[model samples]
Target: MPQQPNCFHAFQQDVSAIKLPARFTFPFYYQPHPLAEIAAEQLQQTLLTNNNWQHNFGLNADDDPDSAVGKMFGILVVQDQQGQLGYLSAFSGKVADTNALPGFVPPVFDMLSKDSFFKDDLAIITKVSNEYKQALQQPLYSQLQRQVSEQNQAFDKALAQFKGDASERKAQRKQQRAQAKQTLSEQDYLAFEQQLSQASVIDKLKLRDLKVLWQQRIQATQQSLDSVEAEIQSLAKTRRKLSNRLQKRLFSQYRFLNNLGERKDLNDIFAETPFKVPPAGAGECAAPKLLQYAFEQALAPICMAEFWWGRSPKSEIRRHKHYYPSCYSKCQPILGHMLEGLALDENPLLINPGKDKHLAIVYEDNDMVVVNKPSGLLSVPGKNIDDSVYSRIKRQYPQATGPLIVHRLDMSTSGLMVLALTSRANKALQRQFVERSVNKNYIAEVTGIVEADEGEITLPLTLDIDDRPRQKVCFDTGKPAHTIYKVMQRTATTTRLSMYPKTGRTHQLRVHCAHPQGLNMAIVGDEHYGTKADRLRLHAEYLQIKHPITQKVLSFKVAAEF
Candidate 1:
């Protein structure tokens, strides 16, 4: 604290959030002009008034407006130095009053605007463009559906063929057994063998002993057949999972590409995949997660097909699995196969309320948590019975409290997820994210050959029924999900990329990457977002945050390849 108590009363400012809450606390994260030089008139005077910077603005580092956005010019905020009290903070006017006190700047009010100022431009595409895009979309979506249909047909055909073949083979085996039993009747066998052995000096051992050996061999053969059947059942289960995943991926890829062709703007949505054949060294978990991540990421671009009953939070969640038993009313035969493949989870399934339920968390802290969930994974269990990554993680680590989520990640996009463990920590971390205090980065491989080495993408996203679960890149309906993507590496087969999702959104990265005006390409391997690949190539590369317990800035990075 300054020993001199020669300052006036509290001075302040008012600020507001733009379309998507641009930044919360302005002065804190603002960087200033390099202190290497200052204006001649304000040089010495600036030195003298250096200590008073914190008095006007809430931050204390040497900063200016030249190098960055919130430099020297902003509404001034004032408060008692010793008091640990202050408002949530607001923005002041841009104009400053020079003739006023040394710390006097502009009068301020309201941290956030009472309303948003965006005027959405939801102009439908031209007939020509619309028709062109539809031509591409219909084929792909239709193909995906066909793949599933054909798959079912093939399975049915194979099953029928197998059953017929099994019946024929079983009949043959039954005939052979019967013939062998008849030919080896005890009376005929004993008499014939005795006559033939009369000439041999040493007849074989006793017939009773031989009969016992034959019975043992028959039992062993039956056991062998049982083991073979069990093995076939296990293999069948594995094949079904693989087939289902593949079909899902193919559909996701087509959906992303079809959406891309419909655009007429900045970048084209790409349709190339970015995965190399599975390397020899991929471990079990690594392979599955990678494949899962790719599918999830691709799915991220696709808007959830089912909404309204999609995302539901805890304060508004409920129990599931209702039951209404009636007296003497039962369908015993039908109930026999009811519980076929319902896997048991620790928690009962919960239903979602809106599109927000499946938002993924990409980053987390003591008070907040991030998730990179699936289109199906709820952000938080809708009802007590619903199972989401949020609920699952918290349950896994009971000691950590306050699983408050600050921002949302697309459920399908494989990216950074964050969370806070406590309310205080949540507030602090939220400020950091809101102020653009954290540094985040990602990697996305689109379908096309992007010529740009580095570029910024600015597109607005809005909710559209046509974009079911997918955010349409309309000027008016959506908030800005800015992304700066660079072509990291390219192959004749695929293109690799690095990206940074500037703002968190329901499906920002996928939609942005696939914007027609931009890349005009789908993120390869992103079945939900763009082109479905073996997996979603999008991965959260880095995250920076102020540690809740340490009170120091901390960073976390995940490799794109991993």
Candidate 2:
């Protein structure tokens, strides 16, 4: 095997003279570098040639080669110490229980190394966990649990006996009253009932003594259970405190560096949040590890890419060989701190320019206007983006009044949107929406086949506050959202559906289509709930509403291009 390049000086003079890549690798999102693609192709070819490589990727020869289960491979374009451009590959998580590969860069932290501090910390954690387990298995603890269980059974039996006795006595008293009723007048019967009640008082006194005795037994048993439970709880608390202390110490040891060479420990990274810092290996994702190595080796990072090379996991949707952006839950905050000094490419999706912007006006009247909105355009002006449908329409009809936008489509969803021209029209249209008199239809292509021709989905939804812009099913504190869908077509791997939303909660259609309890499949190209595609495969296809000023029913339909 060829030896890997140690430094830039190790490269040939010709290779060293090549100019650096024009753009720095985007920290969050990126297209693969041409060289990186070549490298990945080479890696794939190499794996095909070597059966051992398949095993390294956790692929069995017997398994289907096209299975979606896969690993994520990242290639970073970098200049060596001699200023020679080359690519270094790394895989997310681990490959075959190892981080070191012949041509790949090493992990930032080697937790697997026997001599590493992480090993010692892990050992301590293991010991603590075993201690907790052993404490539970102790004879005294087992006896206490058994005693609680036995006493509970006894208490139940005693209570049942008391209830049975009471019922029997009441039955006998009722029979006596019935027999006496035949010989007595109504007034006489009432007097006899008083006598029967007086006789029952003695039985009540004896039952009270029995009740007190059982209550005392239950109380004693409960006290014993509480004492044992307290001891068990104390042990758990001690273990947790010890674990946390060790974790804090471990996290403090992991210090990361940005492009500027400024350092921040893992503890510092999570200081503002309510949670304590995660353990030593937190934030050691493929992207961060690659960047850290590049910075340390004085490499100039150019374009980079990360693509899945194995089967997708059960929880998230990841197609084999597809490039995915860094995860927001884990990588966002860390990259925010790490990419401080690098000049980043302008995010094209966020930029909005004035003038020459076209709004496809489908229909317009004195009271309202209907326009077709393209995918990747916002419905209204946001904090950072102002060139939305509302903004464009406002410029076109500057004299228009009230909130022009009557409803919204997600930025990635293309479709027809209706805007009111005046406050009266807006109020009328808003009322129609509130009363669900306005009917809207959306066309979407989802990831799976639809067995059912049509179905109704009702899921309450609320914004995931911690992860902004993403909505989740929240039964406890969510507004009810309903969607009625009909299958329009079905392909081998996808289904096309027409959806009618009863309530216009944000991302209601997307969530309804993606949630397991609902459709159990995601709309194709839905980036938030599904995998990223060229665009979200959803379009607002039709709308029907009563014209506000004219009081005439109006309907509009647009064909979905997809």
lDDT of 1 by residue, 343-375 (tens): 212221233423354444455444556555544
TM-score of each: 0.35, 0.68
Tell me the tens digit of each residue's lDDT in model 2 across 313-366: 433335556666676555666677778888876665456542244569999988
Clashing residue pairs in candidate 2 (N, C-alpha, C atoms within 3 angstroms): 8-81, 8-82, 68-311, 68-312, 69-310, 69-311, 69-312, 70-310, 70-311, 71-310
Clashes of each: 90, 10
Where does model 1 exceed 4 Å of error?
1-379, 382-385
Against the unseen true structure, what C-alpha lDDT does each candidate score?
Answer: 0.42, 0.75
Q: What's the lDDT for candidate 1?
A: 0.42
> CA shift at 518, candidate 1, in angstroms?
1.4
